[model samples]
Target: MNLLDIEHLRVDLRSRERRGAPRTVIHDVSLTIAPGEAVGVVGESGSGKSMTVKAVMRLLPRRATVGGTLEFRGTSIPAMPGRDLARFRSQLVSMIYQDPRAHINPLRTIGDFLIEGVVASGQMNRAEALEAACTLLRDVGVNDPQRRLSQYPHQLSGGLLQRMMIVMALLPSPELVLADEPTTALDVTVQSEVMAILTEQIRERSVGLLFITHDLDLAAAVTDSLAVMHAGTVVERGPSADIYAAPRHPYTAALLASRPSPTSVARPVSIPGRPVSAFEAGEGCAFASRCPYAIGQCRTERPEPRTAGTRTVACHRSDELEAVLAEGVRA
Candidate 1:
């Protein structure tokens, strides 16, 4: 059985204005992660990557509602009761947010912040949790784990704090992790180190991961499969290598073309037009206005997701676009 399954998932947030309609943030998305597998969700900002993960974590606002199937180990996440949901969150799954400093309490020491959850969840006693934390700290290359624990969040560097957040997420021995751009704030060198530690920990522990980021190359490198999202929908999904080599969707190809290539002498080509939200998408494909290959049919008819060999693509012109998209990536 898949560790996590999301099919045709939709998210809507009720507007605050009086008598205002709810806005659809996620139109449709489908993904699955097997045990010890890493699946990357990559897209530009406002593409619903973070929102999708927020739904999985059950961290959406009170006004938010979900549709379609979202399951973990065959159990429905949306239907889980309050107590069961709490247990599921505390024991079965963990999340590493993008910013550690923002998540950690300013007044609390690192020890208080880290051990509180595990102790409250009964995963470990105080002594055992402390010991485990120190061990993880050392594993992440932190010097003098005991002293670090007593120090506050402000005292630590961005890289070290992120590593500590990773330690906290793993303390519960979760079956799956939702990592939302965990290295976005760090320097390039520190980002590499943090990712290495995170990847190593997940692999050694046999944990599943749903990694969310905008870095296409970084995501493809760390993940087995990649899902390219656009305007709150998954435009393309397949094996990382396959998608990188031959993107069927124009949006995917555009994203690949827009990346800054270190080896290539040519400057990165920017995709024309700005990205839109789910609500902004009209009658047809959200990307029609920006797609270079779009036609009148594409502007009038919404494309549904269909299988194309090893990939699932939501594009009206995927068949003919295959060669052009591949060439774009090669260029």
Candidate 2:
């Protein structure tokens, strides 16, 4: 079953500059996550991947204007009442943010921070929740859980704090987990360990996960499926293995080619031209300026998403591009 559904979701934020028109940071993006499945949304910085998930959690700023059908377990999220929204936020859905330090309260003890949601939601008494928190901390590989709980956020390293955040997210047994670049700030070794723990726990519980990140290889390694985004739109989406083997969209191919490999000594292949902001994109293809295969039509008309084999791609030249990419892979 689908745990989360989004269709034609658009979000416009008030411009940072006074007197400027609202800028549409997210435009007509759609995605779905099935129970027990992990889907990664991969994109460059400022590509709206984070904003899209933020919209799913209803965590966008008040100045943001949002339009879309966001459903969780067949229930409309935007239309939920205050009590339902609170329950959803606290119990049904949990988020692992990018920075653990920013999310936790420095004044509160680690134990208090970990158990607050369970206590507030009335799911467990304070003592019971505290016990559960300790168990989770141990499960996430933290040594001396009891001692760690007594300390403050400032006392722990970045990796340990992130693991704590992961434990906290799973404490509620949430049906859906939205992880926004949960390992971006950690070292490579710690990043891998944290990701492994997260993937294992979420799979054990059969919970849905929406992982957002800019690293295509990392996304492919951790997720079952991927949605490649550019300028607030999903340019391509498919099974992780297939997309990594042969991407159908130019943007997806470019991202894959940009990854560094020890066997290659050549300079990394970079996608030409900077990505356009949503407001800066014109009527035509948003990636036309950077796509080496762009034709006149690409500069004049937007391409709607079309199914190609087992995947979907939003590019007018997808068929031709797929052949080229596949041939290159074989070579």
Candidate 3:
């Protein structure tokens, strides 16, 4: 059964009064998480990847604003009021932000931080919260749960601190956890270790996971499904392995080519242009200017998602990209 569901979700960060008008950061996106499914939302910066997840968490900044339907466990979220939303936040969904340093209180002890996070969950009191904290610390692979909890955030290594934030989010045992770039700061080995800890911990529980990251390879390593965003729209999504092996959109194709991967035994081919800003637009497809095989139709008109072979691709000329994807299948 699906634990979290989102549909036709749209988020616009651009202000018409400013200059660029009606730039939808997250445009008409829909996603769902089954009871224990781990899904990855992958794309480069300004791809509207994080914003879609943030909208579900109700964590979007005031200035950005959110629109479209948001549902969790079959209920519409926008209809959920303030107090109920607050209550839902503690029990239903929890998010581990991209940066641990920003999330942690520099003044507070690590022990205090974890305790407060659990207490806020509304399911645990002081004593139980403390017990959960120690277990959580140990579960995150913290070597000295007791002695270390007393130390401040600065005292812990960057990896430990990042894992601590993960512990805080996981402690509640909420129905869903949205971890945004949880291992970005860690070294490769540490990244793998943290991923293992997260996988092991989150697996035992039936918690639905929305593991958000810009790393295609990292997402592939963990997620059951993948969503690739480009220029504020979800250009492609499917089974994680299938999306990597047969990315249907040009933008996803570029992302796969540019990323570091074992398949790329040769040097990685850099996708030529930088990612377009959320505030960017043109007369046609957002990526038309830079697409290698752009034809007049692509340049003149944008395309909607075309369904084929257990995948979704948003492009006017998906057949051409399909040929490229076909090569990946043979490899």
- State each candidate's clash count: 0, 0, 0
Q: Write the per-residue lDDT of candidate 1 for residues 1-331, one digit (tens) a residue.
A: 9999999999999999979989999999999999999999999999999999988988999999999899999999999999989889998999998999899998999988888889998889999999999998898888999999999999999999999899989999999999999999888889999999999999999999999999999999999999999999999999999998888999989999998888978999899999989989999999999999999998998899998667999999899878888988887
How well is each residue in 61-128 modelled by candidate 2, as lDDT tens digits?
98898898899999999899999999999999999999998988989888888899999999999999
Model 3: what TM-score? Answer: 0.92
Best by TM-score: 1
**lDDT agreement of model 3 with the native:** 0.79
Ranking by lDDT: 1, 2, 3
The lDDT per prediction is 0.93, 0.89, 0.79
Instruction: At residue 239, give the lDDT of candidate 3.
Output: 93
* TM-scores for all predictions: 0.98, 0.97, 0.92
Task: Please list the residue runs of candidate 3 whose C-alpha ends up more than 4 Å from where it truly belongs after superposition.
Answer: 14-23, 261-265, 328-331
lDDT of 3 by residue, 1-331 (tens): 5787776687876564767555567765767788889999887887887788778877777666677678887777778888888877877787887778878999999888887855765688988888888888877778878887789998887778888888888878788889888888677778888888887778878678899899998898888998887777777878999877777787877777776666557667687878886567566787888888789988778787777877777888887668876564444
Ranking by TM-score: 1, 2, 3
User: Model 1: number of clashes?
Assistant: 0
